[model samples]
Target: MLLLFAVIALILNEAVAWSPTNSYAPGNVSCADDVNLVREASGLSANETAWLKKRDAYTKDALKSFLDRATENFTNSSFVDALWNSGKTPKLGVGCSGGGYRAMLSGAGMLSALDNRTSGADKHGLGGVLQSATYLAGLSGGNWLVGSLAWNNWTSVQDVIDNRGQDDELWDISNSILNPGGINIFSSASRWDQISDAVEAKQHAGFNTSLTDIWGRALSYNFFPTLYRGGEAYTWSTLRDADVFKNAEMPFPISVADGRYPGTEIIDLNSTLFEFNPFEMGSWDPSLNAFTDVKYLGTNVTNGTPVAKGQCVAGFDNTGFIMGTSSTLFNQFLLQLNTTSLSSFLKGIVEDFLDDLSDEYDDIAIYNPNPFRDTEFVASNYSHSVVDSSNLFLVDGGEDGENIPFVPLLQEDRDLDVIFALDNSADTEDYWPAGLSLIATYERQFGPQGKDFAFPYVPDVDTFVQHGLNSKPTFFGCEASNMTDLTRTPPLIVYMPNNRQSYNSNTSTFKMSYDSAQRMQMFQNGFEAVTRNNLTDDSGFAGCVACAIMKRKQESLNMTLPSECTQCFQDYCWDGKTASSSANVSTLGPASGSVSFVTDSATSTSSSSKKNGEPQMPQSHSMSWYVVFTTVLGVALGIM
Candidate 1:
């Protein structure tokens, strides 16, 4: 009886193992069940409950859409084959017990395709969808539990449906199946805990914690439905190994100072922390270096004796035109100078000029003399180098020598008319804008009223096309010339009188002349007015006092007088004759002439007529003289 019972027991055990019921029976709890337990324990609020309800509805709709798509594309034969083949080995595919497992696997594949399409459409919207799904899955643990039970019987079928979604249970269960080692459900708290731990570890190590890490861990543990769905993993390891990131992070040495400090630092000052040393040292001290030599205090020290506050030998003016002084301390020093002594000096000059001009003139004209001309035309030389220096007339060369000079032309009339032309040629773009900006600044600063003279030609075709009317008297047009071109048709020849006085010369000939002493006085006055003018800051004026002064010198040769006037104007004028007279005589004839008489005289004085009218040719006269001389000599010899 005992032997029979043992045999029966063995047969029963074998039958149970072979039966499909045992293989597919619910053994492990699912991710969905886990989430339900969490929700129940947490207790959802009214708003949370409503959100959950909506999320569930969306999840059902999405799942149904996935199912419909899957059914349409499904082949039961293919699923059966995949399942049967996969069952023979732990290979990839649906299993032979093709019921819920086959259906779920096919459904998962369909969902995956849908998710891909949706995610690609809009990442944010997909994220919202996933979030909603996760919430719904968490709420409905029963669905996930059932799915998990079905999944165990045919793991291959489970693998197909796994994808990234908000439904914690579905995602977790899918992730498990995709990964194979982790828990079977998407809503498992243990999986989240593991992810949180990994994040904490990265944070502790000073590594950047990103969402990618969480997804990677989840995928590793079979929490994600589709193994490749989350996107490529990005971690510190990847960044450190990649060519681009490695190059970006690589250390490079940079120089801090000139020969005074012969050292290099690994950190780039532009990117990393850098500071200028308040203390000064005359020579390079390698021993005092920190980064290159010894890991000393945060600061670098000099081995040589410390430099006294102001006793350090100064470098020659190695200042760049745009970059300014080299030493980091120089700007601070300049700021201090501007605040104290320089401010006072400027203030005094301005006060003196305003005081001088207050009674004599209502408003002062800020003139920029064109350096290219004989007269100091204040409007032209505003930003030239010669006028920017301390020697205003640029008179270092010596008296009677060509020295670039800046002289201010004072106008009694506050209302001014300005002809502004911008050279729009490729090379002139930079210089032209600077010049125009300066002019605009000047006009705003000194003159309350001004009108720009119009030019007929535009230097740039593009500008002409855009602006239409070429004669429009605004900041427009440019032309290449031997020297700077003036825009006015007749050339702006406004006779600015110091006081109301009638001159005998013609309108064009009546030039405004200021003596050396008078010019100096006016320059001093103008300088003061510019430095002190409240209008300097208003109306978009950049307060370029130095530039304004330079312009004045370039415009007027008068400024060079008593200094470089004679030499500067020598080329401009012939034998001290003004340019106007010389040009008039050479090209336009005398100031006054009758057209009929001039034309007749020109016709009468033709070269052909003059030659024809000659009494005898020079060659004929020379030949006759030679013959006569020879004959005379022969006669004299015969007589002798």
Candidate 2:
């Protein structure tokens, strides 16, 4: 048929086009250890503070442009300029929450809306917000979005998605990750050999290996845009050398994970939170409160000194490995291979390989030569702790229920004035965030093991849903005096939770795959959620966002509050209230609970193109997705 021919033609047209601008060339890969000769333990490194100073000017210029646009008609527009001219810059951050591929796709949409590079985004979107951010953090699947962007020189998420058929496209999730042909450009058999050989090399080097090694390697094929298929030459520390980052052109990126003592199944607020940034890797928790030079991760160090006089390790901090360590929960994909549609032979291969992993090690990333092994100087004396002799084991950061990775931004030393938290978590029965991440974080700040950081008062989960807070944007800590402690003023929070607008973007957290059309729909849904469908329904949303940005500075300078800001606080900020709740039986589906969905005028701002009520792929894109699906399956079966 003509339709079949058209599909085949599309497949052939896209199969071999490789552009120089989008791909990298072969380069040298060093496996040698490169250690910094000096070692010292410090709570906050001087390098980070110095970098922040260099970044301050850049932030001011970006914020000025954004504020001027958002506050165009406000009477106090002059006050915004005065604050900037007086060197009273507002510090800002953005936090992305985790929920597997659903979270990553939605986070990408929010980031695109924040990025000025998105087409016409500045007209109504939160453009230049990302540029003004001092810190950006992610965990689990959210790490894939942040890590991919950081690794690719802060490439626009729109660009990444648009390049679907190009050879340079890194997020090629149409091909299942377990497919041998999906690993690299080599023949399927050779690619499998390469992956196995690489892991064997690490094991032979006396390092412990876990399912995370394989999981991370598979993820690189989807996230790392390098000519060297497995990202073998791309180390996480190499991000420090990029001219954009070295010159402080982008916000600092932080990836998070939860520390689990061996044999432990429960994760609580007291669990040690570990972070990996460009400069270092370690915990801010008093238990193991020292960071090690990230480039030398595989080195055997004790008491902050290399055990071997001249020995060090460098390449072990591979980009894929670091991302994998932050999202070790993906190892479940390997454990549950039987549940997939993979051919029985391929499923057998996965089962046979994973069968060797013990129950405790199945979900953990093993970091041999633990970086925090001998920290006698730390307050908790973690030198002989459970992790020291047994090595470091980490799982998904959300395991502790603090899914937003806000720990780094909460550090008092950072002094962030506002934070825009994106909640793409699947906390409710319908698989949408119900402020669970925020509640978990607020509770942690008040626990016995709580840090000195202050957080805004968040009501119970019932209050969050009853007020429609999860379905619409809300402001927290808009007034500094409303904070729990006057001495520890926290940053203003602009909470944007995922909701249906152009599409129902709340895909189940366990759903592992998305067609190109579904992926694009998810992006559009998130874009509309954050921008309230480009402020079509609520024209004042943009101005309210600007007010949130200026709250700290306005209060600091003792200037009269703008009328628009005062009105915004009244409309968007939650006033203290509580409600009692008992489970209700009314429901939409057989398995559904008594969920109350809010009806906002904003939800109908735009209509979807799909007649079935779910967003659909365009005709051209639908055919292209079919071609890709057919080719991947064909190649997979051919390899077998």
Candidate 3:
């Protein structure tokens, strides 16, 4: 072991010296406003609207295949035929929540169950849902799932899992980010140096770099699978050219973050939420009330106008940087460096980096040359507060408890028929979701900031647990007619909260790593949560999903609902009842045991360690090292 360690150390030292330097790649630019997708206050972008038309056509075909297989044994094909013949297509959006790797893998598992491409998923699966959907949104760790898939041309979650190597590089926990994963084949020194160099390059380019820059760069090795540590030249807009995305063969991906400044408290419903899509970056909130072309984000734009008539910046929206922006929460991961058992040399590197962060400097994504600066295009009261600032800082989307990325899906123009919200939030002590994200969104629809939007009624979080709503799949907005007082009809919401049936998948949000076995267990538990252990109940879970998708459309067409759908609504819809107290509320309760996975074959695994209890970490840390590291690194990184 000593010899192995020394050899690895030497290789790392040599690799660091040879770390690659990244260069800026210019994006296609035009003088026209539409070229940059300059935000219009009226509605959805022309680009998005245009893309949706193509996406709708694609969804129709994908849905035809999915519904045909999903309802194979049904007595009639009239429903499928009607959808095909009718010009109107059902619109679907998936919203995933934030919970570090726990949320990412759980979201993947749910998507796996819905994916038609997964082996053996056709019969009982909500197959083709992803391909049929027009929009997919993710927040925090969930962004990692969306970013990775988008960056990889919409690769299926199974493909990601299948690509795991002998060292378990796909989701390897043994190789810490500080130490660097072996998948890169870079020694520890090389890994650290390469990441440092990448961030330094961005800094040298006159952009402010923070811990998030470093964190995002590190995450690319595991999530992006590119040759460069940061995938430097890759921009989020590049997805527009990928065959799957350009051809509308897959869902449009959106990543979300919240507008937050240092030391400011954000209310759950009022935060000015921002979204990053292929075409642009902006908010639906009245605050900024505009979007700048994502590719030109680093350009000096004031009051919705660029610094020069013919000049706009490029290379600012690096894929890793954008992913890092949505998930700024994990910047805290760097602060936990001393807790790990890393060597003093490595621990000192991380500690020195983090030591410079002042309390207010923590958990922020520093966007210098703020794109919305000096803007008088005030659509809301809060516009003035952010528009005048030279720096636009953002934090985790879930900081205000709206963990699920649902804002973009609620746009009036999207006219979605149904939204499948995958709640992997760790709201409860045991880390299981408690539906707080949905509640926050629901409450926001009626608030001043979200007055124009509509959301299905969701009960309080207490009611969520009291009625066991958080433990199983439940539907909201089953009857839109009943909400006639609202501004518009809201999509039916199918809420699937993470839970334990065969495995305790509620790993802590702070957990930095997991072995492949534990990782698979989390995925399996998520699959079971969504599919009810893949049981076939007379056409099974897919039938229920189909019912949810068809419910709004059927009602719009004035058609009588099918009996299967009626039964599904009754079984899965919230009854609007609230208990006097949640005292007897059942939960997965306290999770115990880190479920161990033993791989038997390429596609097979067995669970062996059923020991009950969350993994415990030692707390004998001497605070001296951590204090010194934080102060030094924070200053050195210019984060202070």
Candidate 4:
């Protein structure tokens, strides 16, 4: 153990190199003239719209490649050609819901299927949709997946697997974060010291701290190991600095969080939904219809500019903290703390940290220097409780019960055509999604809180189970002109729920550790869920996806619904029907998948595209890492 202490000291020396950079320093420079990054939530930001124009090239190319292959018999060749020439291409968004690691990995899989970069994804599934998409949204664990991909140079899920256990690589979750540095208590102790000291540094700087600070710092290890020393100083706003992000090569990513004020106990549909993107972060609701620069989060701001003259601050929007802000500290941390195998000192540290947070508001991500302080957006009367507060408090994006990150994409000004929603929610008792998210979203649209944002009408959980909407892909908002009491057509929603299509991917949301095989299996299973078994024989399914994507513009242009779309709609679109009886326990997909993948007549693919057939597994991480490096991390610092 003495020799191990020496080894730990060496590792600590290496970690010292990552010690908190001056991310939260008082830069003496005056704020930029236009650094008044806050904008009214009337439409998409100019930065985002401009980026979309730049992204048009990539989206069009991706769509053309995908549609050319999938549109074989579904649409005539002439119509397909007209798609690009007429600029009638659809705008797509992808929303991955919360379910902790289950949501993270399963959402990763579903995206793997849509991602054209995945080998043979286009041939066997809806591969190119990811590239064609304009936005990618996530909440809670789903935010972890999306944020991890977006921050790490827009890496692929396969890349995460390929680089497992390598120094500074992400997704090495074999050891619970509670025990990050192997089972050696001394090593874990060393890590804890680093984490505690980092938090202390922030507090010593006069910022408020919470368990979320410690929680986010700990999470940075698995999502970004280079920061495992508890100095996750990288900011989410730095995404704009990435080469691919600057080039607009990938979909713009957004993570969602719900605002909670002092004394607010429960998050409801009316809770203001805040979105954090690279360019800005704020809520679209009239209550706080304004955004502020995401990079300068810690600086005291009034209206739109800094409160302190000529003093701008940086580094408050730490990447992991933003992810933690969206997830909150409850689901991932408290559920594990107070359990066995923890040192008394460690428990004392956590207990002290918990005691410092706002009374009764423990499930929060603290953001000092609230930019919305006295913010005056379009309607001054509707400003929320946070507008005057010195600090803003946020909780899990799904705490309102809308687990899927849909509110941001639903912004009317964004004018989205369709959203491919991957619902990996653990709404059901057994952990599978049961459509509660959609139901909440649907009902919320009619409430005053909805701000007139339109969404499709949805049935209850019973109907979802009876109709097996959870079992397979389902399209809502199909009734475009047919929708009742709507001012105009809303974006169509293509919801893909996680099911046991190939593997039982419904791992518990709080089950923090994942072996390489479990991770890979979940990834593959999510891929298969969206791609469908023998999807090669099911081209209509892809065509149906295309039809949903095209539906909005197609209606606007008065283009006739193609004969192919008629059948496509019949097979997948959900009509406004409710089940009279209560739902029984629902089990979905083939638990024991069969080799003979049955397909409808619409499934079609050429022989050449079938070469690299089914989704293949990536090289797995060695089990030896379990004993070699169980990297657990913990600490929080703030002066609130």
Candidate 5:
């Protein structure tokens, strides 16, 4: 019973898994069916179809035979010898020779000259078409065989050639085996059309019949044998369907900004090439009422008996001026101001229309007299300079002070003076190396300084700290170690030190002292909360220290004090420093000035009790047996 069950299961499984060898599927058609459909579509004659089929079959067979022979030769001969011998044979089809038929014919002469006139001349007529075909086929086969051998032996041959040995023997053999007749066959233009028609027919049939197997077979009949020595034949239908044929069509033109065609102008402001009034600033204006010529530089008498003067006037220099300069000059000035900021204000007009419009202006493609090619001139010439003045000025030495027409007004009170001090300490490298890359996230979120004029790097903490203390209130990025004396003259500092341990005690003391110190009354009436921190790691420790000092100084000047000492003490509470309201302390100023200081010994002693090693005591000691016992023991020990 078990054996029967097993056999039945095996049979059922095999039946379920089995797939039919041949089954009709949608969009599948045979190659023969595809060819017939194409012929029907193209309306080709029976003779044409027959001719293509015969030629294709013969060519494929010849290519296959050639490949086989070549492979065998390659296995037997050295690569260098094979390549040299291979060149003697004639290539087949398009691009057969290195330079095609022209090169082949030039090297070997006409096909008729090489014919065996003494033997086969009687059989083939004057046209010699049959003889040419046969000779070409044989030559193609020989070339294919030789080429394959050369390809296979390439590595070995290259090695010998690179070593600079004799290649003359090989070259001689290749030249001697030339078959001139083969060139004639490939040169036939009609043959290419016939092949093309056959390929088209196969492709059309493959598309309509929905028979992939037939389509593949037809493709194998077309390209494989011709291209790669029949390793596997491909049909023309397959190559067409695979997108090779699609590339033969024409390409689309590239797009341009303006709707006008390339190499043609949409606007002509100067009216040099196209006809229009020269006085008009925008496009072409024919009506003379609104567009009149102007004299840019003229001599005139004004307000005196004989006052000689040169002034720009409208509607004068008509024939001499190519385009009236007055209106264009005014428009150019407005355009310049519109595109630039006060920071990059124009100094003087660099090139006036009269100067730039000279013969030398022709060198500029935009300003070309030919309106058809001067689209860029119409776009850019209306402005004094398209780019910023800073960039332009930096290029031609410094700003030309002698020639400048205007000078910028200086507002000393509104202007801020900032001095940057950077730290070049070894510790900075781990975080902000000298040439460290700015983070992309930071750039996207916040604007950084321009590429030029960034802070310079300074090595060591002392120099940076000193620079910070001495710099303006706008100075940034300083450290606590930068300060000379903490108690005597605590400069207003604003920096978050990297190694907190280095400045923890000093920072605590400074914050507490500033809160209660009387010297803060000399400065402003505001605290450090309003200040901004612009110190990047690249600013270095010195810069940071300087910035911090500046902030402290500003805070002293601006910060207002609360009414009572209790509120003030709470605001600047430093457990590390003494808490006192003593009036005996003297006042001390900034390092550069005098400051007030308090001499409170009791406060100092109390401050020491809050040292790092101190232990905390509970508020209720009466109920805490541990505290009570300790107090009692201390009292008894002191008495003993």
Candidate 6:
């Protein structure tokens, strides 16, 4: 009993009480002393360029494995040999869109299809592609998914998918973000008390506190359960410590965020897009194109160097804080301040917290001693707002309308040959994506900020819906000649928007809660959509994916297209078609059994929390789980 309580006590460290100077504070922070402290984000950071060498070490085997399965029909033995001998195989990138939990779970399903570890994926479905890919970029809700996978030491999506509903599993969203305390874990009071105190610690340590901090902490709980040390100290740069990642065994993870000049116009395609990777966090966009070393954040830097030599800060890139920055849409949780079950004293702290922050900028994440302040004198396109301000500002990546996070992949530095764009944006009234993100990305190329980058042309939303381009898989930038210009040509895009095939994955962008059963249906629908229902629905799906991967590389080598590649292009490529009419659909559901999941309830945002004002985990579980939970809980609480 004592031993059990001891473990429970440690797991519940924050469950009862927590008070520290905030590991994110300057003096108390933990520093990382490897790689350059900072540099101009004129292109990819030197650390990232070096890390690419390590990543290629893993990609060699992965590309070979995937090509062995994908290139069976194509008999270009010498071309394959050239690719292997010269190490010039195609570079692949995957981008996931933003749509809260809907995006996270749905994207996970698609990732599982690409992941060879999934049961029978290599034999009966599309797999090995994720391993072959070099970059995995995500935004908003997608950030939650990608960040969780990397933070957990690169666990497979199938592992997270298969573990749904288990209290200890990575994503236990049965409990809403507002309230993460569940029965199998700690009590509701314990969880909220911890979150409340953590926020206070940041403020007490002399940093600006916002709803993003609280939202990030709660998100960490859902993704990294108590068994994973509750992830309080898990910084994004700590990804360097993961042997799998260090060895280039997993794809590099990039979480996307957008810069917003407070009190300026809302974000648009012109807004600077930023990314958080293990090595650095900055933008390739001309808007303030500079990157500070991820580990050395929170330092007083000027002109990309520390203002005070040898004096730098760390821990500000806390995993939750970075993820929260990308998805600040969750900052709306402050509106639910009256809904939590915190004590009157704690509740007062939240009220004062709101009073201290400007309502207009509550959604923006703060980077104090703004790393780029006054760097415009030496940097290119450093916006005045970024130069004059003492802090850096950021908002949700989706706010700029490029919800799919394709910008980072489109950079010339990456030079990716192909991209699997898994767009789960709620871009339509029915919550289905209508290819708006793609169009926005294409339009940005003509803008002043887009001169350095190249992109494939895309049609409007109406064109997408009318031609069924948004309904299933569609190919963009297929014709190299048409896409080429003075700059480098962009990669072929395999656009896979979320569609209702086997199940309804279209949950509202604002919908906050989902029970285990509903969550599973979303995952299954996404998995099938990508794999063409595990090759049963569309047998040629795997070959088509493989063909897309090899298209640019084959063309570069002046090789002939196989019959399979030719047929795939004819069937799926857009082919300069135009549609003048709009095709509107109410809901793409066979209704998923009356679709009560859409109705307003305590689990949704239209209302407050339940009677206790906390989103508790569902009680639907095997009696055995409850029995063990009760036995364990009774001992921990001294009620055995």
Please give the lDDT score for candidate 4. Answer: 0.72
Between candidates 5 and 6, name the one with more favorable lDDT. Answer: 6
Deviation in Å, model 2, residue 163 alpha carbon: 2.0
**Model 1 alpha-carbon miss at residue 571, Å:** 89
lDDT of 1 by residue, 449-499 (tens): 112222222122222223322111122111113124432221111111111
Which has the greatest lDDT?
A: 4
Q: How accurate locally, in lDDT, is each candidate?
A: 0.20, 0.70, 0.69, 0.72, 0.19, 0.71
lDDT of 2 by residue, 361-471 (tens): 555787777776765666653333533554888777877777788777888888899999998987675778877677777777766445557778776666677778889
Alpha carbon lDDT at 601, candidate 4: 6
Q: After the best TM-score superposition of candidate 6, give how far the Cα of residue 387 lies from its true spot, in angstroms.
A: 2.0
Pairs of residues at least 3 apart in sequence or in different chains that clash in candidate 2? none
Compute the lDDT of residue 416 as modeled in candidate 5: 13
Q: Which residue window of length 10 is worst by lDDT in model 2?
A: 598-607
Residue 607, candidate 6: alpha-carbon lDDT: 19
* Per-model TM-score on C-alpha atoms: 0.12, 0.82, 0.83, 0.84, 0.12, 0.84
lDDT (Cα, tens digit) per residue for candidate 5, span 579-611:
223311122111111221111000011122222
Across 1-640, the per-residue lDDT of candidate 6 in tens digits comes to 9999889766665442222223433344333333235567667777778889988877778878887676675655344566666556889999988888889989988888888988777976678888888999989889888988877878987787677666678777665554444354456667777777766667676777666777787777887784333566566777887798878888889999888764553566777788889988877766666777887777776766676655566667778889999988656554454444675545764565455443345567888878777775444444566657787788888777678889889888888999999988876657788787776677777776687777777765656776789888888988787865536678999999899977888876655666677777887788888877778876877777777787887778776656767887888888766553332121111112221121100111111212243332111111232343453343334333
RMSD of each: 44.0, 10.4, 9.6, 11.3, 43.7, 8.6
lDDT of 6: 0.71
RMSD of 4: 11.3
Error of 2 at 239 (Å): 0.4
Please identify model 1 stretches exceeding 4 Å from their true place: 1-192, 210-640
Cand. 2 TM to true fold: 0.82
Please report the TM-score between candidate 4 and the true structure.
0.84
Worst 10 residues of 6 by lDDT: 598-607
Over 4 Å off in model 2, which ranges?
A: 1-42, 180-191, 338-358, 380-387, 484-487, 581-640
